[model samples]
Each structure stands twice: as structure tokens, then as C-alpha cells.
Target: MNYKDYYKIMAVDKTASQDEIKTSYRKLARKFHPDVSKEKDAETRFKDINEAYEVLRDKEKRAAYDQLGSNWKAGQSGFTPPPSWQDQYQQGNGNFNAGAGGQGDFSDFFESLFGGGFGGGQHAARGRRSMQGQDSNAKILIDLQDAYTGATRNFTLQDQVVDQQGRTQTKDRTLKVSIPKGIKPGQKIRLKKQGQAGVGGAPNGDLYLEVGFNPDSLYTIEGADITTELSISPWQAALGEKVKVPTPTGHIDLSLPKLISSGSKMRLKGRGLPCKVAGDFFVKLKIVFPKSLSTEEEALYQSLKALATNSDKNIEDEA
Candidate 1:
């Protein structure tokens, strides 16, 4: 398939905010919306735009795309890959399984880069009972950014085979795969015809890829929504004020409640994954105390302590 510039189609910067992306999508979607547009080929162009937006607007998919780098121009010819190319360029940083690309409906270029294929009609009949052939599996880990923005990845897979000589050997291969936006952990990608060759053309089993997330994620995902702990000083929580809080989408000014206490939770509506209705972003408050208070600060604390009292009715009555 021809490469589609999702950023260009949406008319937004690659670094555009989630809100900006949404806004750009809405505007373009309206302009090219099949129902309202009068331009010829509007339907096809609109679909392309929608598809591009679908991939670019999502975090996971976008991240995969970013990993592919910006060197390859769409439809540029004179392409040649090196020997043991899969090992040299395979991306395993976030547990991205290169084998998953085998099952997808990709072009020869993509298949050659990744190096696997699904079984043919003849092979499917052999079933799992086929003694010689073994099913292949792979796993890929992706960063939180890639999950939010979508991404393309490259990887290499190796399989060991025992020849008629009774000696075991390893064969290495590689591939490029696209990870869709917003794909969650534990999800698997299947690549057709991207596995070990079937015996006597019996057909090959499908390659399965398991998805995982990396550490150091700014927000922790729970289902559709994302959660993050935000640290605030005691004064900020006691007196409601605007503070910059970090989210997967980036930092934004948040208006905290004046009465918020440590462990209090706040939510940003419709700011999580880019699903149909979209998910929410939840911020859990963590109040921090300043260490080594200054003399002025100590005076203020002492005054406040003098005015604060804890009731001990039982002890008081006994006394």
C-alpha cells in the first residue's frame, strides 16, 4: 500500500495537542465528508483522511509509526535491504513482535522487510497435528508515547531447524510491522503467511504477536482511562489554585479544588485513549510537605499549630 502522510492529511503538526488533532480532524472531516462535499473522488480522499487520522490520532499506533524513522519516502524506488537485515534493524525495546506483520494484508515490500508469511490453503488442512511444523510466536513492548500516537516497528525473528544430518541450526529473519493506535497490553497481532514454511506446501501456521508496555509511563492505564499521581504542596491543596499537571497528552494547567486533601482525585473528561467516546484522565493528588522549613515558615506553622486542636473527649472527661 502507498504510504499516507497522516500528519499532512489531518493538516496538523506531528506535535499537535490531542485537542488540536481532534479539531483538525473535525474540520477536514466536514470539508471532505461524503455527505456534504461536492468534490469528485471526495469519498476516496475522505476515507484516506479518516484512515490516516485513525492511525495518527492514536498513541500506540503513532508511536509505532515514529519508530520507522522519516527516511523512507512514500513510493521511492531503488530499495535494497542488506543481509541479516532483520537482526540489524529489529526493534525490541518495548517487546514488539516482528512476527505479527506476517498475518497482515501488506505489500511485498513490507513482507520482504519483515520476512514471514501465512500458510496457504493446503497448509491449513494439515492442522496442528503436523509433526514437523511448529507454530511461531513473538512479543513486542511499546512506549506510552507510541501507544498514544501509533507507531511502526521493525524486528527480526530466528527459528532453529534440524536438518537431515541430525544437526540443529538457526535461521534468522526480520520484518517491519505497524502497530495500531490505542492498542492495549495483552493484545496480539497476527501476521498471515508469516511463519515457518509448511512441509510439501501443506501450509504454514499463523504468527502471533503479544503486545506489552514499557516502564516510565507518565500515566498508568486502567481499561480505557489513564491515571497519574500528581504531587502538590500543602498550600496549593489548602488554597485552590491552578497548577501545571502532566498527562500522556502533555502538561496542562489544572484547576484544583480548594478543599482537596492528600489522596484526593480529579478527572479530565474525554482526555484518555481516542476511542469513540474517548476515555477520561484521572489525577490522584499527593500532598507534599516541605522539608527544613525556614524561620518565617516555622513561625507560620507554629501559629497554625497553636490554633489547631485535636479533640480527645474520653481523656478530657477522665481528667
Candidate 2:
């Protein structure tokens, strides 16, 4: 677990209003969303943004975090906490505990600074009447290729657990998970009896794993369909030919119809993510003209212009 500066993550002033926080979050969220963004480390950056928003958006949590003073830097290791940190506020009726489930994966420094139990008997009580153990959750990000062909993923989880000293300690556990074909983001896969331990022989709650997609450079996924923009030379659009296009699986030769207009989209049936009923992949053509043409090319264009080729495709006529 690492210490994170929520204010820096959201790029907001410490005294920023709720609306400002929300606006910043929305902007950053869209920029870093794995589905649409092509930036490197988009998923990690998006998770950090979500984690920041999770704490700062909440009034109580924000206030508590603010009390730590702006002097503390993120990722400051081995700094001993002040003894009288929590003396200003007494632990109340578990409002802080209530937030554990929804809050983004928090760090050890955050939990220690806040001074409340996020798991154990109290968490179990909140989930179900008979359960006496907390429900742990983790998010798994997989590539679109993995979804097409199911995969076995090995993940190590750092979970907070209570020790004999009654102090909370983070324990690491590794397990291999089977990613079923056709799983989508935001869907949770529940594993029964895999959560925290129960109190007094009570039944333990379940673990929920949320699914997400890895940030891909060449594809934008929507449901099962994949969309990618392809830049084509002017001649390629004018004269139909076989072109090589990249898919998540591999590059394949696709036939382009002759005289296709710029911005025309071509679809490949059943070439997207695998599902019970799979979707199509769409390639949108974008005509890219050279910034500077060669002398011969210019002469040819001038001749074509003189031949009244422009007469057939005037902007006004199209309009």
C-alpha cells in the first residue's frame, strides 16, 4: 500500500468545492478511461484519478484527510505518525466504516491516519444479517484478446486482515482466476466463501471481482464491437484495392470498394470480441493528403484540375 495525495491526483486546490472536484474528475475520467484513451498507463492513471475522487468527493473523508495538513507528501516512507493525530475527533457510529466498500482501493497510510476498521465483524454486519465477515473486492483488467479466447490470470491481492495483536495488517495472497469468455467491464464475479474470516463460527461473506479492459493502443471497444480509425492516402480511397488492416488478433487483408468517399466506414462481420452473439469491427477511413507534393505529382494534379475534374465534385454541388 502507498500514500497518495488526493488533491494532486485530481489537480485541484485543497479548498476546492464539491462541484470543482466533480468537474475535474469528469474531465480526467474521460481522458483516462481505458475504453477510449490510447495514452500509455491510462488504466493506472485512471485508477489513481478514481481513487482521488473517491476520497475528496466525500465531505467527511475529505475533511479528515485535510486535517493531516498539506505538509505530508505522498509516498513518504518511514515517517512516524504523530501520537495525538486522532484526539481531535472521537470515533463515531461507523460512518467511516460504512465507506470502506465503496471507496477506491485505499493505502495503509490512509487507513492508519483515519483510525477506523474497514473490515471484520462490522463490515460483515453491513453486508448480510447472518454473515459475520467482510466482503472483499478487487478489480481485474484483462486484454480484449483474452476475452476472445478465455484466459487464466494469476493475481496477488494485498488485503487488510486483523492479527492477534488486534491491529490491522495487510496480507498478500496469490491465486489464479479463470476469465470466462464474453465478460464485460463493470460486471462482478462473485466467489463464495473467499472473503474475510467469520466471527464465532458465522458464515463468511463473499469476494467480488470487478472486470475491466486493458488500455489498448489500436482499438476502442464498445460492448462487443471494436472501432479504429485508419489513415488512407487520397489515391487509396479513390481506387479500391486490398489493404492490410490491424485487428486485436492480427493484421488481415481487407478489400476496399472502389471510389469510397473519405470518412466512409467499413465493417467486418463477426471480427470483434467473442461472445454468444459477437459484434463487428468498424474501420473508419480518413484521407491523409501529403503536406508537400512532388513536382511530378503537382503537374499531374494541375493537369487534372485543368481537365475540369473539380467540376464533377464541387463543394457547392455536394451541398
Candidate 3:
């Protein structure tokens, strides 16, 4: 794979700001837009411009690219990424087109630097004695309960395989994965040798599964903390009462403050997802009022209204 000088591609300095980079992209895009441009290689130039903007526009991707340093010339063949680059940027293919490449059109150079791309993140281990297959990344959605108590699940992944014709092709591969307890969102699980096969009995690349929580009907997770709505009657909210509320862990009696407002939150420390620090549990109050009033209840409400009116009039008299 060749090294792509993103700055050179966009005709901008390496230190150009995001706004400047975007401005350059617009100009180049308009000049090379296949639909309107008269340039001979408009489409190819447009894709290159888009690819350059894709890397240079984002702070993280740009920073990762810059780490290769200015020593590498643009379009230089067989550009090898630095050793520590992968450790920092295990970017998942989960969002391919979120960047400037709207069509998932990126060069092998882009794919080699960024973990997720058509290359399956397996660049040849050119320098190492024992060839190590390139590691690949994919995302997995697990239940919030799995965070508290881990569970094992099976997943089907698209893996790159070399056929008899010496061509790379995708094949469906299944593997059972164990979701660890206390694993937070955005964390990754590394499964050994689950990726591309290595040549000459070299070590196979590993597969990384990025962890994500499935949307739950009753709960939402952020970091180690978890939140759930606790329903209570208007009277209970007004007078403060102990109520049984459901949590991810289990049911617990939660005390409500007097005159608690609807949507107000009460927190129970250490009741959230288990971790090194243990996130706190939060209960959001939802006050429900009866749709109808009984005849006797209406009569009692009238009496209370009279008393409240008299009290207001007394205050006015005193003033």
C-alpha cells in the first residue's frame, strides 16, 4: 500500500485547521465533480480529494495520520504504519462513511492506518521475523444486564480469506464470545487468531469486538451509571413515601422526599453497574395522577379549597 500525503492531496499545509481543510475540499469537489467538471480524471481526483479531506478533517484521524510524520512522501509505495499506531487507533468499521468518504471509498493507505477498511486491517508484517496477521475490529451489542453479569454469545463475522486463485474474499465465520463482567461501553474484547490466516505458519491476526449496549425498554446506561424511571402516585410524591422500584440488579425499597417533583432524580450510591469504582444508581420519579375524582373526594377537595382560601385572605388582612 502507498503512503497518501493527505495535506498534499488537498493542497493544504499539515497544520491547516478543520475549517480550512473543509474549504479546500469544497473547491476541489466542485472542480472535479463528475456530473459537472470537464476534467478528464475528474472522478478519480474527486475520490482522492474526498479521501484526503476524510483524514485531514477529523482531529483524531488527522492526528493518527500525522503520527506517520512528514518524512513519508505522498503516493510513496509500500508505506508501513508505525508500530504504536494500531494501539491508539483501533477504529471500528462500525462507521465507515461517517467521514468525508460518503461512499466508503478509501485507499489501502487509509485502510492500513485506520483499523476498519476493505483490507480487513491485515497489513503484512514486513519487518517482524514471525509474520503476525493483521487484527480486525467489529462491534457487538449486548444487554445492559450483561454489564452487571457477563454472558456468552455467538456472532457471525465477515472474514477475509485467500482462495485458490490468490484473491481475497469474504467468508462467514462464527465464534462464541464471552462478554466480561464490568465491561463498559466502547470497550473491546480481543479474540486470538479469529482474523486472517497467516502465511508460512506465522501467527494469525486477532479479532476485536467493540462492546455496545442494546437499547433497553426500562433502563439506559451511561458509563458505569444506570438510570430507570420510578413511577409513584401524586399523593406519594407530595407526602414522600417508600416504594418498591425495579433496578437492573433487583427490586429495592427507595425512599421518596416530600413534595418530590415529577422527573426529579434520587440516587443510590453503589447501586449502578459493577466496576472498579462502582457507578451509582439513579431513580427518576414520574408522578401519576388519577384520571377521575370520586364524588366524596370532590366534596373533600372543596372543603380543603375553602380552608386554603380563608388562609390566603387572613394573610391579605395582616398585610
Candidate 4:
């Protein structure tokens, strides 16, 4: 097997801290993520980054890898572990298991070193029995409007499975899911029997999807409350008026109280998200001045300034 230098792959020094290693791994992972990256070799690079992180992130795996020493370089062909390495690992000194289905994209070298049996150690001597598959977790992004109203969503989930020949393979499965109204961010929806296939006809594992919201340009969601900016002219603040304000359900006429200041908020009862208990919609007033004033508009502003000056002089004379 070829030797793999995980530290070199992550571009981190041997003495790098865990936080430093994580930062580097995340940066490289984003740069090579297949869905977003335009690089030709993004898939391969992404796999490499994941493999490196899987090993280095675990203390047992890192210790085992560090024992391999600096004599062997990455990509060196026909390199094998020391004669006593297997014996040492079998003694329970380097037992490690990947988190959930995170072991899928690892390399042959990693599998040989750490993917032997249950818990990545030698198999137990007890008789084998059918076992249920492991549960899987994933995050799904939805529009803010979807949370306001129930919607149907389609998702393609990628799963990893070990074949009869003990080779890991990836399978894609599509599912149509119904998103219930009032589902908030960080809430999870569970789909039963949708995870990895069970061994020996045992029941399949469950899939848990954590919900997240896509950023909305019009509104900011806070818990059940929704806030939006309402732009109004200076005269509208000085003299109250009824204005049409947009809400999640629809637009409603809002009465702007006289002498309302910029950054003042108006509440629309039961007009936010359609949850078990409806949330309030808030409109934060923003006083906007005209970008440029016409000659006629400028004269009006001058007249107001003279009136204010005359009123101040009259007060001084009375004093």
C-alpha cells in the first residue's frame, strides 16, 4: 500500500493545534467541495480533505498515524506498516471508529489501517448476529416562505454501503418529503427506515434532517416573530398616514402614529408565521429623505427654517 501523509495533505505542521488543523481542513474542504467548486479535480481533492480530517480529528487515529514516523513520504509505493503494527493495533491500543457514515470516502490505506472490525479493532469471538443499520443525519435548506406555509420538497440523499465483498460504495436515493408549516430552523424531521440498509434483513436505520432557512432579503426571522424594514418620507413621520405594509400572509394597511421616529416599530398582531400560536409581524420605520431636492422643494425647506428662526427670536425677546 502507498503511504499517505495526512498532515501534508491538510497543509499543517506536525505541531499544529487542533483548532489550526480544523481551520485548514474547513478552508480546503470549501475550496474543493464538488457542488460549489469549479476546479476540475474538486471531487478528488474533496475526498482527500475529508480523509485527512477524519484521521487527524481523532486522537487515537492521530496517535497511530504519528507512530508511522517521517521516514515514509506520501505516495511512496509498496510501503507497508511495521511488522509489529498490526499486533499493537489488535491489542486495543489504536481502536477507533468513524462517526456515523463518515468512513465512506476514506482511502484503501486508511481502511487497511483502521477499518478492520467492530470499533475498528479485531472482531469479537462471539457468534455473529444480524444488526440494525446505523442512523444518518443531514441538513436541508428551505425558503422562509416554506415555513409560513406547508410545502412538498424533493431531496436526493447520498448513502454509503458496504457490499458483500467488503467494498464501500455510494448510493443515491431520492425522497419526496412534506414540510409541515411552522417548522422552525434547527428543528429536525425524522424519516423512518430511510437510512443505510440493515444487515441480514434487520430493520433499516432512520434519517434525521435538520431544517435551516435560506437568507431572505425582505425579512428577518426571530423565533416566531418576523421583522421587516418600512421606508417612509420625513413628512410621513411628522404627519401620520395610513400606509400599506407587506406581511407574510399579505399586505395590510398600517396607521403610522404622528411624530413617529426612525427605528420605531409597529406591531401587526397575528400576522407573522402561521404556527400553533400565530406570531406578530413587526415593521421597523425608516425615515428616508429624497436623494436630491428640486428648486421648489428647497424653497419650502427655507421657509420652514425662517419660521423656526423667528420663533426662537421671539422667545429670546420675551425673556
Top lDDT model: 4
TM-score of each: 0.53, 0.54, 0.58, 0.58
Name the lDDT value of residue 131 in candidate 3.
29
Positional deviation of 94 in candidate 2, in angstroms? 34
Winner on lDDT between 1 and 2 is 2
**TM accuracy, model 3:** 0.58
lDDT for residue 244 in candidate 3, whole number 0-100: 95
Mark the regions of model 1 whose C-alpha exceeds 4 Å error after superposition. Answer: 1-135, 169-172, 309-319
Q: Give the Cα error of residue 130 in candidate 4, in Å.
A: 1.3
Query: In angstroms, how far off is 157's CA in candidate 4?
Result: 2.9
lDDT of each: 0.64, 0.72, 0.74, 0.76
Candidate 2 residue-wise lDDT, 235-298, digit = tens: 8887988889998788998888888888898999998877778889999888889999999999
Which candidate, 2 or 4, has the higher TM-score?
A: 4
lDDT by residue (79-181, candidate 1, tens digit) is: 5444444554443333332222112133344334432322322232232122112246788787767777888888677766667885667877777878878
Candidate 3 lDDT (Cα, 0 to 1): 0.74
Query: Per lDDT, what order, best first?
Result: 4, 3, 2, 1
Clashes of each: 48, 0, 0, 0
Misplaced by over 4 Å in model 2 are: 1-132, 309-319
lDDT: worst 10-residue window of model 3: 122-131
